[model samples]
Every structure is written in C-alpha cells, then in structure tokens.
Target: MDSSFKGILYPTRLPSFGRFPAPPQVHHLVSWFWIPEWDIAPGRSSRQHLIAFAACNLVVQHDGVELSGPTTRASHQDLSGKGWAVGALLRPAAVPSFTSRPADLRDGRLMIDAPDLLAHVVEVMGKETTARGAEAAAVFAAWLLERVPQVGQEALLANAMAESISNNPDLVRIADVAQQLSVSTRTLQRLAVKYVGLSPSALIRRRRLQEAANQVRTHPGLELAALATQFGYADQAHLANDFQRFLGFTPSSYQKSLTAPL
Candidate 1:
C-alpha cells in the first residue's frame, strides 16, 4: 500500500540528550535514546521525524521508573539504558512519554484515536528492521508521513470507520458518526463498505475492542471497576468478559502481565 501517512515521513534528529552510542542488535525503527525529560513541547519534537511511528519500541529504562501513564511517576535514578518501550503504529492522542493529557500530542485524541491506518507501514518497519539496520528507524518515519496509504481512498475511509468504533464502542451507530463528521450516514456507510472490507459498524467495533486491550493495562489507579467504566462496561464482570474475548486475559490478569518480570 502507499504507506505515506503510516511510515517514516519526515527528517529526524536527536534532541540534546545524552550521547550514548547505539546498542548492539539495535534495529532502526526505534531511534536512539529518546530520553524522557528532554523537555519537548506539545508538537512533534524536531527529532520526531527520525522515529518510525508505525513501529513499536520495547523500551527498557536505564534506570527504573514507576510510570503510571504520562504524569503519574516516582523517582528513579538515572534512567539511562533501560531500553523498554512499546511503540504504536498509530498517531496517538496522548502526549508522549514525558507529558500528561492527550492534548499533549496534537489535539489530544480520544482513547480510540489511532485506527489501523498505520498497519501497513508498521509491517514495512518490521521488514526493514534488519535490511536498513540502524537507518530503518529514520527511514520508516519518512515513509509514513510522505503519502497516504497505497489504497489511499480505501485506507482513509477505513480509518474513519475504525475511529467511529473508538468513540463509543457499544452505542456507536452510523448516524452518530454522520453527526460527528457532518456527513450523511449513508455516505459514511457506503465509503466504509466499499473500501474497508467491512461495514462501518463492524470496523468500529473492532477498533474499540483492540484499543481497549492496551488501554486496560495502562492505568494503575484504574482498578477493575474504574477501567470497566472508562471503556463503557456495565461493571467489572462485563469488562472482564469482553477483555478475555479480545485479549485472552481478564482485566486483572492483563494488569498483572505488565508488572510481571521477564
């Protein structure tokens, strides 16, 4: 697909952080030491162009950190070489690692802000991980931003449909999306069915469930009851049941997985 908006699309540089050399077995889809506390602003960092947004980063901090989402924190000493981060293929609504609030990144997208539009580009990043080696990270970033997906029309429509699912998973209807985007329900439905390989409703549901998988694990303060509410569940039981279907783990199990040692 024409992965323009999904892969690396811009030039990138390192922010004035530490000067550590690249790690061994270092794949390029992730840049070097995107160190926290560099004081980047709300907009994309100057070095943002260097990162392959479509790719995932499994970051392990040099120093330990107690990160409860963006702002919730604890004091860890020098978090230098802890290379653990999980990168997403989608442009998220939340501020990056350092900041809190979704508005920190772009307009601060809602939880389901990232649809599957970046999937193709994410795949490309996986392929380039070794071939391009260290350059893969930077190169992938440029690819994602330079153009729309190869199936440009299909991808955009599909992405919109997916976004619809994220807004309100259970109660979403084409009429709701029509109202939100200011288009007729029929128009949105037609575009989604024609290009996305699924009806708009189907796509939306899928996005909502997939997004909840990751989100359920993100908030430490959110116990079962609270997390269920955030994701629109009637109660903890309902949320756990859905969670098992989508993620194969109950909500509590999911949280435990994150804290479990390797």
Candidate 2:
C-alpha cells in the first residue's frame, strides 16, 4: 500500500467482461485515491480485465478514438477521461480531437508511460507511500494526473450526456437536445462521439440497459415482455438479445440465479 494516496475499499466490483463465462461473483468496489502532482503509469501490459480510474487531470499520448460498443484490451485504450462522470461539467477543455471511448481511463496505470507527468505528480504529493499502504491508489492517481487534462470542453459534454442519461435512461435522441442547443444533430452526435466517447443514442441505450438490468434484478417477478416494452425494446426477443450482448447472461438465467449466492 502507498501512503501518498488515500485508499478506501469500494463495496462491489464493477461490471465487466474478461472471462469467457461471466464470473459468479459481483461486488461494487471503488478505490478513492489522491495524487497532488503529475505522475505516470505504464500502459496496460497485455492483461485480461478492465479497470476504471478517475482523476481531475488527464492527458493522452496515443492513438485513441471514441468508439461505442464492446472495447477489447488492445482497443479499449482508445477512450479516456480525467474526472468523475458528474464533475466534468464545470471544466473548460475542448473535446479531444481523438480519444478512447468507454474504456477505463485508469486501468493498467503504469509509471513508464508518461514520465514528465509522473514527475509533476510526485513533486505535488511530496513522497512515496508504497512503503505503507495504498500503493495502487497512489500510483493510479499519479498516473491519471500525468495523462488526463485537468479541464476540457469534452468533460462538460460528457457530463451533459451523462446527466441526460441519468434523467431519462430510456430516451436518447440527438435531435431533440442538439436542436435545442441550436447545434445540428450531427454536431451533437460528433460531440458525443468525439468528446464523450459515445453516440448520443449509445449513451442513452447504455443507461437504459443499466436501468433495465437493475429492474430485472430487483423485480424478478416482472415479465420480460413488460420490462422490455417499458424500456423501449420492440419485445422480449429484443430485450433478450441486448441483455445477452451486454451482460453475458440471459435475463431469465441471470435473475433465476441471482439468489443462488455469488
């Protein structure tokens, strides 16, 4: 553990895909880490699994494009961010001309990737803490500060997209809001694609899927047809198709086994 970073154990593991078959266990866990200055983490080392990282400052040095849908280890590196999903709203940096969409920005943080940024963070944090506790957290924060920009318009747009999803997870239409903003639907789509790393529709669908799954888990008795219709699916088949693609489990099986013990 590293003392430079304050580590707090999160209660559940994040949602992800790595193993061919989904793991039987799922817990929501997050590590809150802090780094006062710039630091760097090496790029991912060809490993399985996705990790999520958040920070106030981030930069990029590779070919990252904002893409929607399942991102692989080799490709997930395309999207990145520097702040909380909610906090990016108050920032000023413009959207990245390029980025990696939907992948964990803080996953696989390594010091060798950006040395100058790492130098900046170590200078801010004052000392190393791997001698004590929170080593991963400290190094991770430093790594983010080294890579992500502290402020950007992309952050704001991402925040907006997030807020939009939160308000109505099932409804996402670029035309509705973009025209309201006096921007073309194309412009909004571009913004979401470039800065937020999701098409407006994709973000909406992602949020809806999350909400739908939660409903399924919490209300196992609900009919799939009803749930699917409520969430904007054409019918049960549409819902089932999406559920399998995103979660790796059929909705019925996922619900049936929910109480079998993780």
Candidate 3:
C-alpha cells in the first residue's frame, strides 16, 4: 500500500496491482487483464470497495476459477494472507460467450467447472498466477483467441454501445444514446439489458458517477455544486444521492477520507 494513501472508495490505482490491455485478436470481447499480488502483514487485511462497471470478469485464484457478473451497487473484496489473482475483464456484451444469461449473474458470481468455455483459460491461469506483466497477459490472450470465434454479432454491438456510453461524458439520457445510434429507445433498452446486463440509463448513471468520483479524488477541494453541474447532475444533492447510492459515501466525505492520514 502507498503509505501516504488514505481511505478511498473507488481506487483507480492499487498498490501492488498491474493492468494490461488485451491483444488485437480478442480486443472486442476482452477489455483488459489485471493481476493483484499481495502479502498482508500478520493480523492485517485490506478491503477495497468498488462500484463495478456493467461488465463481467473471469477471475482465477489458487482454489479455482469463478465468473463474476456486473454489480448493480457497491461491492468489496478483502485481501489477506499471501495471495494473487489473474483476472480477465470481459466486454459487457461478450458475457454471452461465457454464460447464456448475463443478467442472471448480476450482483452475483458463479463457479467455473470443467467442460465449460473457460476451462482452458482457467487451467492456464492456474499455472500463471505468479507470472507478471506481459507474460501473464500473453498466456491469457492466447487462450482467448481460441474462443473468439464463438463471440456473436449481438455481443459486438453491445460492446460498441458500452464503449460509446463510457466515452461520451455528456450523455445524460438513454434516448439520446438511442438517437445517436439510430435505434429506438426500446431496442436500445433490450440490447443493453440482454448484453450489458444493465439498462442504458443505469449504464449512463454509472459512468457519470464514475467521472464524478474521479474528479473528487483528483481535486479534493473542488466545489460539489460546480462538479455536479459540470457532470450533468441536476444539483449537488442529486450528485450526493448518487454517490451515496453507488459508492456508499458522499462526495465530500469521500474526499475528506482520501485527504485524511492513514
């Protein structure tokens, strides 16, 4: 852990973690890869709280592999002992390649057994937990390439919609996104729910709150009213409500916690 670091609800940078982009071949299905290696001191553990994006993840630990779905609210994980994890951040729409119903796993997780699409990747990640940097990424990418052929067109479109949502900060309404994509609002909602495991409005809200959290962290003294207006919130209260709903903390309190000493 960074000694100077204080409490932060959404940690963009972790102390002993590494994230790498996926290779071109599987880029559409896989967003990025992450590895976290940690050795918590005796009688000590670390907990990280996060507002998970509208996406799924394939995580490999020493015990076995697990498929984690998108979370609707805040989630956390406790890190203890000497442990490590190799994780694949799957594109929201690409969830079908691994599971039939993305929404079924929302705010929940499932175990990966043999005879599934992820078995081979699980096998490889089992052996590569100690591999670092590009070596671990390469091993994961090679496995993903074999399964790329299974990704369908709906997943591709869903991934593109997710990209659009995350990239456009000014997007406030699902109707606006539907207009931009030349689709009806109902169609867009169906696609999002089916592929991304979230409604378009939910996705927009998640992205906006994420931006707000980053702004609060980077500029601790920034005015909440101004930040709220800048990010399309109706008012500071609206923003604070979202922060409380999704992050379990108000923006001001979150900033205060971050600035406080460890």
Candidate 4:
C-alpha cells in the first residue's frame, strides 16, 4: 500500500512500522501484514491508538502469540522498552476458520498457547526477534501456509460478503448486503455474528466509521456534509453522532486535531 493510505486508520506513531502484502496463497484470507518495532527511552512509555477495523488479527509478540477478535471500537496498545511484533490482519470472513466462533472472541484477546500454533512460526522466525523485515515476512508467510488451516465454502462466501461491505462506502444497511448476497437479512445477521464477531448492522456501521475516519485523516479539508452523504450517513448530524460515539470526537473536532500543531 502507498504511504498515504498506510496510516489511514491510525494516528501517526511508532517511527519504525511497516505494512506488507500477504503472500499470494494467503491473500484471500489475510488483508495485509504489519510489523511494529518500538524503542522507548527509560522511564518513558508510549501508547498507540488505532481506530479498529472489522477484522481479526494474529499478533505475534516476543513472548507469545495472541488472536484478537474484531473490535467494535478503537483500541489502545501500550509500548515500553524494546520490542517487535508481527501482525496478520485477517479478513473479516476468515475469523471462523481459525477460531470456533467469532462472537466468543469479540472485544477480547485469545492467548494461543497451543504449541501447534507457534511451533512452526517460531522455527521460521529463528531465535531472533529483531530479524530483517523481508526475511521475517517470508517466514511469517511460510508459517501461515503450514499452520493456518484451509477454510471452506462458507468462509469463502463470507469473504465475498465482507469484501463487498468493506469496499463499498455506500453500504449502509444490513439489508443491502443481504439483498446483494441473495440471502435474507436474518441469515446475514446470523452469519455476521457467528463468524465475523459482529452483528451485520454493527459491521456495516464499523466499516462506515472507518471510512469516515480515513477520509478525515487523509482529507482534512473535506466537507462533513459531503462526506456523510458519500458514505451513506443520513446527514452531517448523523455522521457527527457516529464519530463521537465510536471515535470519541466529532468530525470537525477530529479534523482540527489532525491539523493542530504537534
């Protein structure tokens, strides 16, 4: 991805962070990959805030591996001393294949202590947590190929629905997705909650808010009314309500914060 689009959902922090594409075989299951390395000064710590997206993640920390479910709101990650992590941002539809139920994992982190989960990844990463980015990525891909199990037709269909919801900014209602997929709204809702860790409406709202924040960050001067209409909010006031509810700031306030002196 381009630098302009890299930090679309996050505030600028962590001077040493890079995003990489997943390997071809895993592209459908994974959206993109990221590695974050941070060094903090003594007696000082930093916390990075990320406006969450509608996806699960595999976070490989120095100590262990964590499976994070889709978040309904923003997240804050603390950093101290020196450390690095490899994160595989799973597609919204891919969550069920790796875990039992997405709803069980929502708003939570599952510690994957199973040796089966990390044995291949640890071997591939070698004993060095500070490996080069390219080498680490290759290892991660190999681990993915060897460890991440294959998904089924249901997962593939969910992936299509999720991709549609994510790629289409105008998607406002769960009914829209149901109609697109030729399924009933109830079916869509069930699938979303069971496999995506969110209700269908909640997923749609999350994606809309994500796009809104991205636009706010990438185009500070964009008109809120125009943005609301573009992204299917009923009006500017509706957009403001969502921005405040999920992002803890109104659209204009967010824009000003982006432009304020550092």
Worst 10 residues of 4 by lDDT: 1-10
Cα deviation of 121, candidate 4, in Å: 5.4
Ten residues in sequence with the least summed lDDT for candidate 1? 66-75
True-structure lDDT of candidate 4: 0.75
- Per-prediction RMSD in angstroms? 16.5, 11.9, 4.0, 2.8
lDDT score of model 2?
Answer: 0.40
Off by over 4 Å in 1: 1-171
Q: List clash counts for every candidate, in order.
A: 35, 44, 0, 0
lDDT of each: 0.38, 0.40, 0.75, 0.75
Candidate 1 residue lDDT tens string, 1-262? 2222222212122222221223322212112323222334554333322112211122322222221221111112222322222232332211132233322322112232222323433343345233323333333334333322233444444445445554455544667777776678787776554433235655444444444444543445566786667666678898777656633557687567556653
lDDT, candidate 4, 50-159, per-residue tens: 77667788888767888898887777788899877878888755576568787788779888764654554556445555556656666666666666558777777777
TM-score of each: 0.40, 0.49, 0.88, 0.87
Relative to the unseen true structure, what is the C-alpha lDDT of residue 194 in candidate 1, on a scale of 0 to 100?
41
TM-score between candidate 1 and the true structure:
0.40
The worst-scoring run of ten residues by lDDT in candidate 2 lies at 83-92
What ordering of candidates by lDDT runs from best to worst? 3, 4, 2, 1
TM-score of model 4 (CA atoms): 0.87
Instruction: Report the C-alpha lDDT of model 3 over 30-83, residue by residue, as the tens digit.
Output: 878877778888898888777666688988776777889888887788888887
